[model samples]
Target chain A: MSLLAVGTLAYDDVYTPYGEVKMIEAGSCTYIAMAATYFVQPVQVVSVIGGDYNDDFLADLQRRGSDLEGVEVIPEGKSFYWAGRYHDDMMGRDTLDTQLNVLADFDPKVPESYRKAPYVMLGNLTPAVQSRVLDQLTERPKLVALDTMNFWMDHALEDLMAVLKRIDVLIINDEEARQLSGELSLLKAAAKIVEMGPKILIIKKGEHGALLFEGENLFSAPALLLPKVVDPTGAGDTFAGGLIGYLAATDDLSFANLKRAVIYGSAMASFVVEDFGTRRMQTLDQEQIDRRVQRFGELMTVSL
Target chain B: MSLLAVGTLAYDDVYTPYGEVKMIEAGSCTYIAMAATYFVQPVQVVSVIGGDYNDDFLADLQRRGSDLEGVEVIPEGKSFYWAGRYHDDMMGRDTLDTQLNVLADFDPKVPESYRKAPYVMLGNLTPAVQSRVLDQLTERPKLVALDTMNFWMDHALEDLMAVLKRIDVLIINDEEARQLSGELSLLKAAAKIVEMGPKILIIKKGEHGALLFEGENLFSAPALLLPKVVDPTGAGDTFAGGLIGYLAATDDLSFANLKRAVIYGSAMASFVVEDFGTRRMQTLDQEQIDRRVQRFGELMTVSL
Candidate 1:
């Protein structure tokens, strides 16, 4: 099964309590595609990157089963860049700078081969651009999951709601959930967001864990608590990518399968945060992933 | 098996988004004894109360199999009183008033019959009072769990550390754990805390859930999501009470049994938060508690 991943590809400078890394390859799309490729081949890439972007990274994506046919190259233009410093707690951060270059006018065009992809993961972007992706698809995807942030909810909520009606799943963090639903209680917030459209909603709570809501069913997934967290920039996007990729490969949308998928996705996210800027994702093998997931299962197991 | 519960008996005026109540029955000892009575009878209560305290409430505790012989009543004195207002999110609150009338000079005296009890639950109190209770014990209990707060850590660090070295189990909220161990990471904090004394440490996260750490084993229990939380008073004490009560009744301290006890404690805490003060605890039956715990098991179940 093929999956279409539409989002940004950028260069990031990050600072954490452990150390600092500069000009690293990072973005929602980069993390999503990398995480999804582990579960399904040919994760079609639908994003824009400046010519200055590393050619070696492109080769790396191709080697990992990512189709670059849909990726647009804007020569003489700079890629989107962001610089941020994480607080001591590692849960909060401050954005030092943001330079939207090629991404300022990104008009995503889905390649013909990707239009009929079985799964789609729309990483954080403008709602209008996200809706454009859905409008170009020739065949309905088995599952369409969208990841968003408080930025879009604040700037383009009307358009966001328009896209919300077209997707099968919505993934966002806890604060965004509260902002979207205007409710203090998460249970009440999930109820309100599900009414807006998607059949499945995943609310990610950074270190606390993630909660899944489908109709009357609710699943709470516990996050694996690591002794150290190097970086957490793309943990949420990686979680979404792993989730959709698992569903596409298994082709099961039942609540039971979704529960397992949440655990798998959480397992992937746990690995991403262990190192900076998708470093852990680079050399991960199936044996390592399976072992990590087994640990997650053990971490949550309790007969009573 | 009998359990000794040493803490304060008081009245609480609480305000929540749902509504507000004035001078409602509340106290650490009251909630602990009431929750523990579900599993073990003759929950011996050691607390100081004023003549103004309700007679009906004391009679109610007796009806629920609580031994009031250890509870000292001062006819001319007033009870400990507190008033607080919950913020919109319900996780935070500001204390409006505190009147430590009878509790100001409380010197807990464990009764002769309760001195040799198999289980002891030391609720939030002055470290000196808690230590005095422990000193009065004629025999070492099978399990001793102590619940404390940041106030004691800030004011009575030496005494708190002294008491910490004597308990078998230490239960405190997440923030308190961080403050006590000076570690932001809960896993690391738990490690540092176990070295200080207690063999088992439980970190309670109000709405998020609870964590149990024993040697190399860790159990995460999810809090039941309630659509409406009237007030969250006495939740932590209730959790500790349920846990100790279950252990006392079952007489099992194995790690596996502790895992079950966490869930059982979490179930009782979920019920107490549904209404103000101890209204829900006043009317809970064994069937209700068992059913609630089964739901907790289902909430955390995932096979991957």
Candidate 2:
């Protein structure tokens, strides 16, 4: 089974309480492909980048087993760039700047060979763009998981709903869930959102962890405890990547399997936040991940 | 294996999005005794109330197997009364009124039998009053657990710190933990607080869940999923009661035992939030609690 990861590849200027970084390699696709590569090989990535994007970063991702055949690079255009400052709590942030650049008129093209990838992860993007990626799929993948933010619900709800109906899973934070469903209670929000489209809804609660809902069955995943979060830059996208990647590698979509995937996702996320951008994700090995996963199990284990 | 509970027994008026209730039987001691009685018999309760306090409610608590010999009746005064409105999220609230009345000049007198109790729970109240209860105890209990709020931390740091040094366990919400330790990260806060006195720390995160930290060991407990939280007034005290009660019943203080106690606490807290004041807590039976505890286990169980 193969996983198709489609989203941005951009440059980010981030400021956190620990420190600040300039022109760091970032974006949803960057994180998704990196994390997914740990469980599945040749993460087929489809996105648009600009000439300003660093070649070394591309080489780094390629070495980690990402297929970049579908990435459209504009010769003269600048890459998408964003600057943000995290609040002291790290849960909230203020976006200082966002430059669309090459992404303004972007069109995503799915590589013909990647069209049939069984696990497709549509990272945070314009809902219309997410829907277009689904159109290019040769067949309906085993799981079409989309990650979106509150912006889509506010400005492009109709388009978002269209994409929601087509996907098998929706992964959004608690705030996004409330905005989309107009319900404050997460259980109520999950119920209404599942009815709207996807059968499975995951409400991510940053440090608090995530809730998975499939009809009457619900699973809660705890976030790995950390004394400090150096930076929270790509945690969510990394989580989505690790999740879909595990599902693709194991080729299992059972609810039980999804729970394991969430733990793997959370484990990957815990690493990403330990450092700015994806530094920690790049350096961690399978053994460290296995131990982290075990720690997660231990964190919630109790003999009663 | 006896447990002593000391705090205020009062009347509360609460408003939530669901509805509003006025002059209901509410207080830290009331919730604690009710939840603790399920696990430990003759929960020795020591608190001060007034002539205006409902006698039937006290009789109801007594019926639940609480030993109320230490409760003081101030016939000339009125019971402590609180009025508050919960925010839409049910996490934040605004205090509309607080009349300490009888609690203003309270001096707790631990009963002779209760003075020798091995397990003790100090609910939220003036640090001076809580210290008075400890002073009257015949000997140091096996485990002295204290619960306090930010108000005490802000107004009586000297007295609060003095009480902190005497307790084996410190159970407080995330915000109060941060406030007391002056650290934004909970892990850091737990580390700082534990050094201050308590050997074990439990940081409760209302709907998010609870965390237990003992030295280098840590445990995370997931909150039960509810469609709606009717009211969250006494959830914390209920959690403290359930936790201490379980410890007293089993007479175990191992980290593993503490973890199970946390799960029991979380289960009890979950029920408290289902209805306003103690309405839900008063009606729940042991069978329901057992099922809820099993649910807590299932909520965090992941077969990785």
What CAPRI class is candidate 2?
medium
A27-144: candidate 2 lDDT, tens digit per residue = 9999999999999988999888888889999999999999999999998999999999999988789999999998888899998999888899999999999999999988889899
Error of 1 at B45 (Å): 0.7
Q: Which stretches of candidate 2 lie above 4 Å from their native place?
A: none
Error of 2 at A192 (Å): 1.1
Candidates, DockQ: 0.75, 0.77
Best by DockQ: 2
Per-prediction interface RMSD in Å: 1.1, 1.2
Model 2 chain B weakest 10-residue run by lDDT: B293-302
Model 2 residue A30 lDDT score:
98
